[model samples]
Structure formats: structure tokens, C-alpha cells
Target: MGIFPGFGGWINQNIQQPLKTSKRSKNGKSSSVSEEDRYIQGPWYWDPDISPKEKAESMEIDHVKSMPLSATDPRYYDLDELVRQNRLWNSEKKHPWNGAPAKVKVKTKKGLCHLNIDFTLGSPPQSVSEMFTNPRNLMYFHSMGKYKYNWRTRLDTRATKVLKKDGPRQITEVEKVLRWKILGYNGTIPIHLIIDENHQKVTATYKKVKVKHMKVFEGSWKIQPLYVDQERLCKSRSRISEEQYKKCSGGKGRIGSKVTMEHIFEPSSLLNVPPVSWFIRGIAVKVTKALLQDLREYVITYNKTETVDPLVYAKIKESIQKEKETELKELED
Candidate 1:
């Protein structure tokens, strides 16, 4: 039988009787709480009265002191090792997500399993003022929404106004600005999604991308510094006579005296590079009851009971020293 689309493939295959246990509570009492309530139970903000900056600083200090090592190496996440350990743990666990037993399929590849997390709440921001409350969600929305297509709004109004006073120059500058905005939106989101996938961290950034010019131009185009092209002009064919050059000064001084061209190029072009789209994505290892309690208790107790164990201590030191040396070598190179 084919598994349902939205329900994960693994969950559908493993589940024999989905409604039986889920229909009733563990103690055979009716389930009072909703599934949505479980996810929303966590504290959203850490006492808003105390500023976020101060709270984050305190948390940072606490986290640093809590970990054994000053920095935990993300590179040390061994898939095979974690899978073996997780499987062993899973065998003894009873997962809470599903009332029945749950298990994770360990693949040879590290990131083959998909962890799709989506909230039912549609398009987070209720108003412009509310945007500040949820930056991460807002950032993702902005990148995907207004920021991408809203380039004209972001342009420096003072600069655009000054250029507009010059008639023909205004048209050129406006067109250039519009082109930049369209290109900006096209590339920002897609690359950001890729970066989010790789780093396992949330970030907001304008991603520069390369793309084939379709409507705007005939071929591939790229953004570049203006001077890079302007500086390489071939030998001048028409030399203005000294009198002509001097006449350009309006008789105040020597010709061309006030014509020393210095282009303070604050110019940026959002060239139509390959288009990119952005999305909010994340991964989470579900805490489940699939594991045996005795083994689970042993692992947690082993780490907590003894502050300093010789064998474990040796292994930790060896890993840290090796890591330090590797980092040092990279720095030296």
C-alpha cells in the first residue's frame, strides 16, 4: 500500500494501528491537551521586561560555563556513531510523539532523512509594528516577500532625488535603480535557502547571484565596479585644444580646471544573475520514548554521576588536543 503524502514515509510504514493508542491516553484517560498545545508550551520570550540583549548575554555566559569544552566541535557529529547509538537507544525507548513505538531509520548518508517543519500560522506578521517581535520569522518573510521585489523602496531617497533634478540623468538613474531592485529580489532568497541548509543556523543576508540575461540583455551578465571598465579606455582620439579646455572653466580659471572628474561611485547593480529563492528551514531530532529506560538512565547517569572519569577524560582531552592542533595548522597555512 502507498503511504500518504503529507504523513512522512517512515511513519506510515511503521504504523500498524495509528488510531488505537492515539485515540486514548496512556492511563486510559481521555486526552485533554491538544497536539498543538504541546509545541506551543515552551516559553516564547524570556521575560520581555528584561531586555533581550541582557537576557542573551546572561544565557551565553551560562551556556559557556555549562559545557565541558569552551566550544563544542560540530565536526565531531559522526553519523554512523550517532546512528548506532541512537538505534541502540531507540530499541529501548518508548516515543512520546506517537503513543506507539517509534524508530529512526539510519541511512548510510548523513543528511538523507528530511525533517520538514512548518507552522500552521500563515505569513507571520500581522502589522508593520509587530514585525519587530519575531525577527527570524519576519526576516524569512521579508526576504521572500517585500525585500525581494521592493527594491525601489530601499533606494536612498536623497540620492535618487538629487539625480532626478538633472532630467535625462534622472531617467537613467531611475531605470538603473529599478533594474537593480528586480535583480536583487530574484537572487536573494534561493541562495539563502542553500546557506541555511548547510550551516544549520538562521541568517538574514542579501545574496549575490549570477544569472543569464533574458529580458534585460541578450547574454550572461555580472555586476562589477564601474572603474574596472572606465579605467581601460583606449588612447584618446580627440584632444581638446588648450583654448577649448581652458574655455570650459567659464573664464574663472584655466580650461578644464574645475573638470577634474572624481566619481565617488556608490554604485551597486543587482544584475540578473541566476535567480534564487529563500525559505525558512530547520532540523530537529525528535525526543522519543523508543529507548529502554534503564539504558537511557545509565547514559545520563554515567555522564552526570562522575564529574571526572579517567577513560572518558582521556578521550575528551585527546579529541580537544587533536582539534586544537588542526585549527592551529589551518591558521598557520
Candidate 2:
């Protein structure tokens, strides 16, 4: 399905308004119409000529709540419950130093610190990896208006190369360099991120990306299998066949994936102050949550549309099947 069904009609109704061109009067003066007003469509003046009962019904229909029509729509989310759960999870899983979801461990000898955060995503590792590695998708996640205030953000992929690969379960390494910049930023932040895919895990790592705000910035995103109980799996479904549940349960339970993001960075002197650290941490949490939420929504939207790449989807399906087979083998052993 299209991201928004009936989007053409929506554009006609809400965006593509017909404009009335401005005209100068014979008296060498423009009419009362302002420049901005001339570009705006005039207010609706057509008489509906409908019955009072019909008008009341129309009003009622306009006020009636409807299911989400698109991934970007606000009605698609349970905002209060999601926020509450995310906050509670972050609070309960905080590191000792700061009350953030990421653990901070200082390496006194090396004069550096590591920030580690782990969470579970709803999708499989292949889909997550594909989304994260794509330059366009990365921009969508990072340049979210609510989370990022900067404008004119751009992401350019400099190069991509496959280094080496073994079997499906063996290590497959790929490297990519990206140039990123935002409006008002002095210079571009060039990132060299490496992606490692294996049977058991997929990881993306970047070491030291120099930016104006930080002396050091490095991070890794890793995904690995996670198992959940049958009861939990059943909560996601209304009904399940006994045999089907047993097969999917794989003796232990249904399989999911745990995603971890780790970063180590030293801020520039301007933002290295004590108070600024707290503010930065707050922003980091908000942005991270927003990124995850957007990723989930984007994946759902992509799956519904016909624009998905067949080759990539095939690889993802194969990887998932392999994972299931591996899990079954492990159970047998």
C-alpha cells in the first residue's frame, strides 16, 4: 500500500491551493490584495445546498476518531503508554555514574570513556542493519524535526566496499565513508563506519569521527538474538495453533534480537562543562528514543509499500531462515 492512501486528494485539499494572480489597477496602484494573499486560495464560498440533518452528520463524521491511515500520522502511536514504558525502562536500566540508559565507564589510562546502551527492536537484525546503513534512512532518523533543530542537513556517501566474507555464518565485512553536514555547522563530519555481518550477529562500528563539537566520537551498533517466553509471544497474537507454537517456540521460546549502541566521545571545551554534560545527556536520550521509534515506523511503512528492494528483502528472509535453523540446531544439541 502507499504510505498514505488517497494522498493525491489530500494534497489537492490541503496543499495545492489554486492561486489568484495579482493585478495592477488602471490608477497605477495594485489592488488591495497583499503579495501573500494573492498566493493563497480564497476561502470556500460555495453553497453546499444540503439538508440540516446531512450537515449534522458531516460534522459528526469529521469529529469521529479513525484508525491510523499512515505511519507518519499521530494516530498511529500510543504516545502516553510508549513514553511511560520507555521512561520506566530507561530509569530501571540506568548506569551508575549518570541516570541514563547508556553505561559510562572511564578508561583512566587511555583518558577516554565508553558509553554502552542496549535495547530490543521489534524487527529482525537484517532489516535493522539495512535501514541503518542506508544513507537516506540515516538522514531521516537523524534529521527528525522534533529531535534535531538544525536545518539543511545533508548526508553524502563517499565510498562503499566489500572487504571479505566467509560462509553465511562467517564474518562478512564492509566499509563505508560518509560526509555529513548541517546548516550553521562550520565543517562536515566525515564518518568511516564498518559493517560486520555474521550468522549470529550484525554490527556497525565507527572509530573517531571528528566534528566541531567533540574531540572524539566513536560508536558501535550491534544486534544479536534474544529469546522470549511462549506467553509473551502469545500476547502478540490473538490465537496460535499448538503445533505451530511448538515449532516457533523452538523448545525455549520465540526468537527476537537485542540491539546495542556504544559510543565513546570527548566533547570540545565549549560543551565539556559539568552543566552542559547533563543537557547533552538529556538530548541524547530523547534523540535515541526518537530514532528507534522512527525506525520502527519507517520499517512498517516500507513493508506496506511496493517500493522495497526485492534483492534486499530476499537476503533478509534468507538470513532470518538461517537464524531459525541455527536456533533449532542448538535446541537439538
Candidate 3:
């Protein structure tokens, strides 16, 4: 029933006002997540037939704006096409993936922009995946707005839910209720996404669930080994231990993952109009890049800070408690 560390911050950071930050435990340790993980809600609430109108009402949104683009517009990209030649961040010259001022990037395109945020970590792809792929990590890993007139432009996300179909046609679905505010103007966008996780490709593709509007929001996450040759060389040394790889190889080297989260965002007709359209689009792009910058900080502090992945350590304790309960039951029987 009580709030845990950092969870409320992620939920309220994007809103017009921020919530009171949650406090840590007595020893400054984070407690396990309670069941009310609205951002990571499970399939029990899934309904493939729920109309978008009904969904809007649930969020207390009175209006759903009209679409400005056609169904065939290139801006409304397919999930697999989330990464395209249009990606600005792919260029190592102009908007390099690995760069400083995380919120910075190359020029964005009209109506949409594909953001590729690439970074390396101290751990391998599997550890990075464990930190990211789990919904529980959403609470622990985020960078909130620092100042009042924060230079960072971004969408405020309220809650996220994982949806699925009951039948064979069901694929993983992710729904996010995001708040958009630019230059004192604001609106809400409810996005339903279809998630495609390809293990072999080491990528997760997300596209709009059922594209009703011309507005588009789709993206892909690519996580793969960064310094393979360095990793191989690290293992070649018998004396060098697993923990030593983070510091020993060239000082900045660790056989970590190169994570690329590419997103394509285009707003609806309500905000896509002339006067403020350009400004809003630019804000969206910057906000996304800012989010990537936040992720950089989030990942770096994962295991080393007060905020750690709840699902990982919490699961172990849960399993042990279950085993103890089973033992008590057997003895009583």
C-alpha cells in the first residue's frame, strides 16, 4: 500500500506537477515492488476489442483529436520500418549515437523523427537486457526534469500497461498514456503498441497497435555486444577475473552492450498545424533524446546505487519464502 523508492517519480515526473519523492528504507535500501505496477500492468486487463474511445474515457480524457494524415503516409511508419534511412542519429558525423549532452542530436524531419540513442555499459547484453526488458525497472531507472524551465523538451508519460490477446493471434501489446506539452501548449496521446522481440536479432520492435490516426509513434531497441574483441582478450587472461574486465581493458573498456533505442514520433492534427507544429515536433525529438540521456544515467547507476532492479533480487527472495512455506505445509500435513 505504501510507495517505494523512485516509483512515484517516474509516474509523476512527466505530469504538469511532480509528486513527492518516495523515501528509502531504514538502511536506505529499496523495498520490493508492490502489485500496483500501473506502468507495467500485466495481461489480466487485456481486451483486444476495447475501442479506443473506451480507453480514452478510462484515462479521464474528454477529447480525442482528429487525424491530419492519411493512412498511407510515410510518417505513419510500420513497426519493422521504425528504423529507416531517415534516422538522423545513425550518422556518426552529424548526430552520432555516442555523444555528449545526451539531449543533443542532428536536425529532425517534419512530422516525424527517428532517434537512435546508442551507449555502452559495464555489463554484457544479457545483464543489460535484464535491466531493461523487465517492466519493474521502469520505476528505478529514469531521469526527471532538473529545473523549472528545463531546456529538455519531452512528453510526460503517466502510466504504461502491457496488453495481450486471449487467442492465438495475440502478440505482446504495450499501451502508454503520454502527456505532450510544448511552449505552454499541451495534450494527451494514448498509444497502443505491438511489441516484437526477436532474440536472434537481439532487437525489440514496437509499432502502433491499430493506427486510427495519422499521428505515429513507433520505435525499436537494439542491444548487442559492443567490444567483442576486447571481451575475447579479457577472457584470454586467466588471472583476470569477471569483475576486473570493467576496469582493466583500456580503463574505459568493459565487454558491455551497445544499446540503440530508435523512436519515430509524429503528433496528431491538433498539434501538427502550422504555427506551433514545427516547435512541437522539435520539442518531441529533444524530449526523446533527453529520455535517452536519462537512460544513460539510469543504466550507469543500476546496481551501484540505492535504486536496483526489483524484479531480479526480489524474485529470489520470493522463491525462498515460497520454499519455506512449502516446507512448513509438509511438516504440518
Candidate 4:
């Protein structure tokens, strides 16, 4: 719906997919972001380190951080547990209008706040993962709800910087500007994140860039295919086959995505007092929930709509074709 002019053309061009550079002309410019580089890295378990490194094939790494999609990597948050609680929460059959259909909770852990969110979407995990990470969809993404818990109603978000590293696995260093209001006071937050996009496993692993305002931030998003046809849980979710996915889709041609996001973070402020810290943590929880809500609503609302712009469709098609070409190249190698 061209509701927003040119889909917010005012958005910085860095947020769009960067131009591909061949081996001969690589990393020429845009190498160092002097503006954002000074912020530093946080003390999170999965901090984003863009330093040069040895290839995974030549290294004996034990952590997923070393080799994402590694079988030995810590699963971090448990999807099975979250999905169980989500079912229980929804089965109660009593919820407020804005009460998200997911199990969301936040608690103070050590000196930081830990938040875990779990929910299921109607689309397949691949589709959901692709839509959320694709830059083409970000401008069109927006939340919808009239409930009091809707904080995004007073939020303005834009991608300020994005560096897309395209390869067998896409790595992106991005920073976003979030302007929000609370208690009639306006505030702006800079969220710098390193996104490890693994479409093969349907996961986006993100770690925070330790900016001056951010003290701690690390997280991972895992989307698992649910066997919607049967009432029981899926026995295997990793790289599921097309036939099995179809059989488990409940005949609607629409699969389910068991989505979970886990993050721990703290602000770089001195509000360490009892109630002040609690209040700050509360704000963090609200912001996390609001962001997740926006994504869910965008996926559900737009996936079925026919108003998707032809240009956006073309971009997605091009992306998929390029990805397939890359996959074939790796296979041949």
C-alpha cells in the first residue's frame, strides 16, 4: 500500500543490500566506519568480532561462534521448553487483546537482564527467517495494534548503518536508530548489531556492538519447523525435507515456525540503584517485546497480502537466485 512515500526513501542507503565487489576490488572503501568503530565491543558471550580469522575447515573450534551451524555449538535457549510453555499459555484461553500469543519473560541475571521470547508463526521457518533478515522488507515492516501495551505506536525506527558481507553465509554489521517515548519523555537509542544469517539452519545469531550507550547485549534467533499436522512435537527440525514439511503442514500449504529469541543486555548507565535499575530493565523488556511484536505482525499481515510491490518481489527473487548459485558453487568446490 504506498502509504509511506517511496517506502521511506529517506532511509539511508547503507541499509539496502550493498553492491557486490569482486576479488580484485574488494574492501576498497567503507572498510572502517570511524564513526561507529569507536563504540567498542561489549562483554557478551557472542560479541561480534569482525577480525580476520582462519577458515573453519582448518580450525578445531568447539564453539558455534567459531563455526556457526556447528553441531557442537551450544543451543543456548531451549526451543522445546519454550514451545511447551507457549502452548500452555495459549491453551488457558484467557488473554488480553494485546497479550501476545507467545511466552515472554524477562529477569535480572547477575548485572544484566535476560529476556527469552517464544512464539509460533503460521508460515514456514525459512519464509519467516528470510522475511525478517532481508533488507528489502525492513522499510515496509511496521506493527499494528491498538492495545495499551503497544509501545511501537510511539516509536520511530531506521537503519543508520549496514555492512552486508555476502558469501556462503551472509554476515551483516548493522546499526539502527530507535526513537521512542515513555512517560512523555522522548529518547533515542542506537542499536548496533552483528547479524550472522544462516538460512540453512534458519537462525540469525546477533551480538551487540558495545557502543557507549550499550553495556551488554548478545542474542540468537532460532526458528524451527513444527509438525503442525500432528498434535505432537516434531521429532527432527534441522534441515527438514520438503516432503516431510508438506506432510506436516496440516494441509493448508502453510507451515509453522517455532521462533525463539534470547538476549541478555544492560545499559551503560549508572542507574544501578534498586528501583531505578528495575525500571530500566522494565523498559528493556518492553522494547524487546515491541520489536518482536512488530516482526510477527509484519510477517502475518504482509505474507498473505497481494499488495506487495513488484520491485520488492523482484529483489527477493534475485536474492534467492543468487543464493542458489552460491550454494551450487560450494557444492562443486
Segments of candidate 2 deviating more than 4 angstroms: 1-114, 135-156, 163-188, 194-200, 209-212, 226-229, 232-256, 268-286, 303-307, 312-333
lDDT, candidate 1, residue 115? 22
RMSD of each: 29.5, 18.4, 16.0, 14.6
Candidate ranking under TM-score, highest first, comes to 4, 3, 2, 1
RMSD of model 3, in Å? 16.0
lDDT of each: 0.22, 0.40, 0.43, 0.48
Each prediction's TM-score versus the true structure: 0.14, 0.42, 0.48, 0.54
In candidate 4, which residue ranges exceed 4 Å CA deviation? 1-100, 137-141, 145-167, 229-242, 245-252, 309-333
- Compared with the true structure, what per-residue lDDT tens digits does model 2 show for residues 154-203? 34333333333332221212222322333333234445444444422456
lDDT of 1 by residue, 79-127 (tens): 2222222222223223211111223332212212222211111100111
- Count clashes in each candidate, considering only residues at least 3 apart in sequence or on different chains: 20, 0, 1, 0
Q: What is the lDDT of residue 164 in candidate 3?
A: 30
Model 2's TM-score against the true structure: 0.42
Which candidate number would show the highest TM-score if scored against the true structure? 4
Poorly placed runs, candidate 1 (over 4 Å): 1-296, 303-309
